[model samples]
Target: MECPNKEKNLNRCNCSYPSCSRKGLCCECLHYHLRNRQLPACCFPDDVEKTYDRSFEKFAELVMKGKI
Candidate 1:
């Protein structure tokens, strides 16, 4: 089934990974990341998102630093 909010979600998506099929699909993106033991790009700020360090550790660090 097509996601009705894909376009709207894309407007807010911060993923920097190119050629991502899940770019605008939050559910798929989240599931993919979780399966890899990582968080999706949208979980971090633009700067951090670009670093591609979507690990739970990274997210926790950012949270502790109040950067998220």
Candidate 2:
């Protein structure tokens, strides 16, 4: 399904995955990441996001460190 907010969402999406098809599709990206036991890159800061470590563990660690 075509995302109606694709353009708008892309403006705020921080996903740095070079060829991500869901870059501008928040719903699809969220579902795909959750299914894989991960969070979308948008959940992370750019520095952390670039590492591509979107796991729940990573998020928890960041939260504990007050980095999120």
Error of 1 at 2 (Å): 1.6
Evaluated against the true structure, the overall lDDT of model 1 is 0.93
lDDT (Cα, tens digit) per residue for candidate 2, span 1-68: 79999999999999998899998999999999999999999899999999999999999999999998
Query: Which one wins on TM-score?
Result: 2
Tell me each candidate's TM-score: 0.93, 0.97
The 10-residue segment of model 1 with minimum total lDDT is: 41-50
Q: Per-residue lDDT tens digits of candidate 1, residues 2-32?
A: 8999999999999998999998999999999
